[model samples]
Target chain A: MPLDLPNPTDLAVPGFIVLMLAEMIYGRMSGRAVYEGKDTLTSLLMGTGSVVAGLIPAGLGYGAAYYIWSEWRLFDLGHAWWVFVVAFVLDDLAYYWVHRFGHRMRWMWAAHVIHHSSQHYNLSTALRQTWTGKLTPGFIFALPLAFLGFEPAIIAFVSGINLIYQFWIHTEAIDRMPRWFEAVMNTPSHHRVHHATNPDYLDANYAGVFIIWDKMFGTFIPEDKANNPCRYGLVHDLGTFNPLRVAVHEWVGIVRDMWHAKGLKNKLMFLIGPPGWTPDGSRMTSDMIKEDWKRRQAVKEAAPANIAAE
Target chain B: MSLLQLLGSVIAVFIVAAIARWLFPVRFRLEDAHLHRELERVYPDLEPEEILIDRAGNAALLRLSGARGIVVVRRLGDKAVLRHWMPGTKVTATRTPTGLMLDTDDFTEPKIVLDLDAEGVSRTESWLALLAAPDGHAHAA
Candidate 1:
């Protein structure tokens, strides 16, 4: 039987709209959950572009996925309840690494950075996705599942479901879920750290559905609003609200850096290195920023003691 | 996605944006306490000794107590962009009829136009003098 599955994200569209409006209304009344008109518009338009981008027939997305399943699957693991359970969990693990790479590696960050370009964290911001995500080949992470015999349709369906689960976690409306739920699942608080530009929060929390993956992989950092209130958006925030510029800004950065870079090795490093990598170390990468943060923290801690000593 | 869904996404995009504009309509105005909190992450625990806010309250210049150069800040749509002036940094300033025209080599934030009155202009020139060395280079070497 030919595999046919309705995209879960498509079905979730109406719910997405309803939830976004609810959040907006709550923001209005409570004076929290703020959203700027232009930021929200840019986010929504980016979401729309992503949906359109996926429509363009690409061998990389479902095409190559289905091919791997048909020709080279190690086992014909027939559709079972257990198969879907496995696919969902496994796909999320792949998502974790893909997301991690999206931050650490500039080539992938070029596409993934669009989603984080917004300064506001709201449901609409969840829709702020990458127009070129498909081109970056994150799906390669899912290829192992196809080879292990899960159907591409099944993977796509579960992937959509995983995405839908993530949409609710994008808002600042919710502080924390129940302790048990927070322990196992990705929540609003955890996702906030992922979106934050705080030095300590950089490159943390790359979970999809289950927060366990981040914990297992040692990438988890619990949200601490007291010490580090989440500052949304990139480390170097974009100056323009234009959606086109927001989408392709990192790619443009890469092109310019590579063009001026002296050696072929240095130019190659520009593509694979961290987001702010520079030959002369003019720009600070996440690690450098974190080191500086630690140094500053030590200084502050020592100041009180030194005063007492004095 | 269906044609109607496509249309819905488009309409809802604008509608949500419109609702956001209606709900929380406050444009961020730069303030000392607010800038202090925002720049804490960038400058650590250091505090600004002198500060100048533009007439429009969208940009600011600050001179730190022990630091040599002024920090330049310009408000984007929803956030403030901070740049530390250094001796070798590419930057220039020109006086305009209404205020000051500032240019920098930063790719994302290349140009900023600050509208100021006479007193504001005088303070700005002082800040510029503090930021620039005697040889016309930034003082924060």
Candidate 2:
């Protein structure tokens, strides 16, 4: 047989649609709104673009992995069930780092910001993806799995599986899963915290398949419903619904900042720094935003008691 | 996938998407409690319970009891910009054939227009009355 190299995501397209419809139905029956027309269309368009834009880069990434496996692999870990399992775990770990870096680093964030542009979180929001991730160095994160002697094909397969597992978590239909399952796996609740832009929920729960990574890394934050209902989207909102603008808005922001920057150091910092970081102390990072919110909240909390004492 | 298969997948995806849109629709739910909670968070001193929120939460309009100023919270993506309309704030709340137009001092371009129903118009009138008052927090409406 000719070396069958088919994208696994292609096979999952039908299933994705079915689950989206199911989620919409469940949401309606449960009296929680899950879908918006323009938002859904925008998300779908982003996904379509991401997949198409990803083609050449995906080939390059796979080729690099294959080259390493063939010429420079550390071990000849042959095609065994355990090897596949190991590859799966390693691929997931790679995904976690790629995702984290996508958030932290400005260049990666320019691509990743498209995913976070949607205000409403739903099945379609899962479809909201980055058209420019291919241009970024994100694929380098997965090269380790291939270098560890797993075939590039196997790595690609497991990566697809990882993505499919993550798809269901991008939803509001299913609340908290079983306590044990929620503790172990990345549930919808955990993912909701990841998607939330609220002060408490910002930059927490960056897990792909396992919640263990977030917990181990100390980035885990539980969903708090009583105090703060999860507000989805970026801190500074993208005021436009145009899909093209949504895709390139952050990239444009990065360019603008770099162009206005005084020196080479500042221009480079604009590319490598965090999303909200500026050369000057004007803009706030997620850390700064969270700290400011905490201080304000503390003041607000103490005000009534202080007044009473007075 | 072949060209035919690709076309088929596209058609199927759109079909499903269309169904989802039809089922859910895009109507912003302006819950009284939710609005009150949000308002209190922003303006802690203002009476959240006494505040009136329009049912059409598209362009959320608010009027506090005995307060001359109106609060218009515009939803942009996930983040909302809460525009405070004090007595001194150069903001005009006019009723158009389509809905209510809020021309404010903050944003000059792409004016704030809300597709208010009859109830929303009445509520806007009640809130705008506060802006017409000479003294702040003295108006009943």
Candidate 1 wrong stretches, greater than 4 Å: B45-50, B63-70, B91-97, B100-107, B118-141
TM-score of 1: 0.90
Q: Which parts of model 2 are misplaced by more than 4 Å?
A: A1-5, A57-60, B29-141
TM-score (all chains, Cα) for each model: 0.90, 0.78
Model 1 residue A127 distance off true place after TM-score fit, in angstroms: 1.1
Docking class of 2: incorrect
Candidate 1 shows a clash count of: 0
Q: Supply every candidate's count of residue pairs whose N, Cα or C atoms clash at under 3 angstroms.
A: 0, 0
Whole-model Cα lDDT of every candidate shown, in order? 0.86, 0.76
Tens digits of per-residue lDDT for model 2, A24-129? 8888889665776667777887887776675645667767878888889999887788987988888888888889998899999999988888878898898898
Candidate 1 docks at the CAPRI level of: medium
